[model samples]
Target: MNQDAIEVRGLTKRFGRRTAVEDLSFGVARGSIVGLLGPNGAGKSTTLRAIVGLLRPTAGDCLIDGAPFSALENPATHVGVHMDGFGFETGITARRHLEIIRLAAGAPPGRVDEVLEEVGLADDAGRRVKAFSTGMAQRLGLAAALIGSPRTLILDEPANGLDPDGIRWLRRFLRGFVERGGTVLVSSHQLAELEQVVDEVIVIKRRALFAGRLDDLIRNDVDSLESRYFDLVEGAQA
Candidate 1:
């Protein structure tokens, strides 16, 4: 088996005249959590979508565990994904939504309740998705990701609607995931919150700008991640 959880080589994406990502390459190690950091319109979402096979890359390849996402024998069992603005059926109950995914993923029957409790949504299991709060809906998305017991998790802006307490819960949950040999690739515009949870990060400005250990980037830097991020991005633009 490949040691890297994910590998992107010479990745490029274009939309008409706009080049969203260009020749991007990086590897996420096994049993680690890495953050994808970029300013808005910097192609982070496009890159993530391509990695999960939601969007075909204009050039190059994204490999998960040494194979293309579509080439995986049972993709759901290997990768869990939560894209930004992920959708659910508004009229469907949370439990039913998860049950549907469980069936599709071929997971065990009890997996729905297990993930509901895991995300602290068991009480809202019967609640219609349309009635859910933003945080509750985010939890439901996370529950769907956890349903297949995947070894690698890909989440885009997962902290968008989370409160302080919910963010804390996410921190713990992701830490536990990496501790148990799972790999996590989380993309977020919130640098401070991401700084708290990531071991390393890949920073991009429509291309690969920096990819290294988080401690290395922060070392000898007095400013917080937000400040440093501005400096890096502004310098790149200049």
Candidate 2:
């Protein structure tokens, strides 16, 4: 049996009177890449934030290898996270930014260059973050998340700013990572791109909407993946 790498049980989050997520539960199997899909304000980010311990859940829990993320002895080595709003000081060079994180995370300093190379940012390492393009910034965030060589990755909209070539590279990278026993839970609104990377998907609209293999969501008819996804999410809200 495949072990669960990440598990969210009855996860809920609220901000004042607004309930962001409600009793959301799902799991990403070890060595598999799972997609978190939903429309805007559909609790996708909330769930990811809760999983990474960035936000406190009003109810329920998220676990990595059966333990809360905060409880990990060395969180960096166990899990790497890249969520929305992650930023770097504009004046800092990409190398410096990662060096700071490497120091804090107890990762080897040399790993910074390795990750930059991994993310196709090695040549741009000396450039200030403010000077990088949106796609480059996204690549930097990914490089930071990968610095620790964690077993699991939790990312939100990882392909947000990638160009066609960069997006293609990311797809191959994610697949290679999982083939080596790494697990990933990535969120994205790009259904076609997402479909190319994820083995399974867990969708939500302020609650658990759908959870299963991606093939299950695809119908034999002419309706595209986007069309099918909208239908599912819309049906849940109705």
Candidate 3:
């Protein structure tokens, strides 16, 4: 198995005449937490979708564990992904939702209870998903992604709708997860929040603008990640 959790080389995606991502290349080391940062329509989602096999890349390839992700025999065990929306059954309780995913992924039943507690959803396990607030739904989504104990986690805007406490919990939880030898790839417009937890950052503007450690991205300047993000985007436009 490869030590790199994810590898993308010359990735390109086009929607008609617009190029969403162009020649984007980056590698994520195993057991590290990396943030994917970009403005609206900066191809952050496109790049993530391509990596998780949600969308076929027009060019280039995405590899997981040193092999083509598309060829992975059991992708669910290899890569756990949570996108913008919750894939919940509204009428089902949180426990039931987790039960379903655990069974579908062929994971052990104990994992269901474990992840619910991990995301602070065990107390609300009996509540129907329809009654969940946006924050609660986001927590449920995270619980689902963690149920199978995947080696790699790809989350797009995982912090969406989370309250201050929830965000803090997520940051700490992600740090713990990475500490335990898991790989995390998360994309968020909330750079400030991500900066608190991400070990490295891949900043994409019209294309691959910067890819390096978060501190290095701002090493020469004392500006915050958000300010540096804006500067990178503006420089791309110019």
* Backbone clash pairs in model 1 (N, Cα, C under 3 Å; residues 3+ apart or in different chains), count: 0
Residue 134 of candidate 2: its Cα lDDT? 88
Better of 2 and 3 by lDDT: 2
* TM-score for each candidate, following the candidate numbering: 0.97, 0.96, 0.94
How far out, in Å, is residue 185 in model 2? Answer: 0.6
Tens-digit lDDT track of model 3 for 1-238: 5568999989999999999998999999898899998888888888888887778999998888877778887777888889974478899999999899898888998998899889998899999999999899988988889877888899888888999998998899998988888899999888789878988889886478889888887776578889888888888862
Sort by TM-score, top down from the best:
1, 2, 3
Per-candidate Cα lDDT values, in order, are 0.91, 0.89, 0.87
> Residues 8-66, candidate 1, lDDT per residue (tens digit)?
99999999999999999999999889999988899999999999888899999999988
Best candidate per TM-score, number? 1
lDDT of 2 by residue, 1-238 (tens): 7659998999888899999999988889998999988888888888888888889889999999889988998899989988778888999999999999999889987899899999999999999999999899989999999989999988888888889999999999999999988999999888999877889988789887789888787767676668878888989963
Measured by TM-score, how close is model 3 to the native structure? 0.94
lDDT of 1: 0.91
C-alpha lDDT (0 to 100) for residue 192 of candidate 3: 83
**Model 1 error, position 217 (Å):** 0.6
Question: Which candidate, 1 or 2, has the higher TM-score?
Answer: 1
Model 2 clashing-pair count: 0
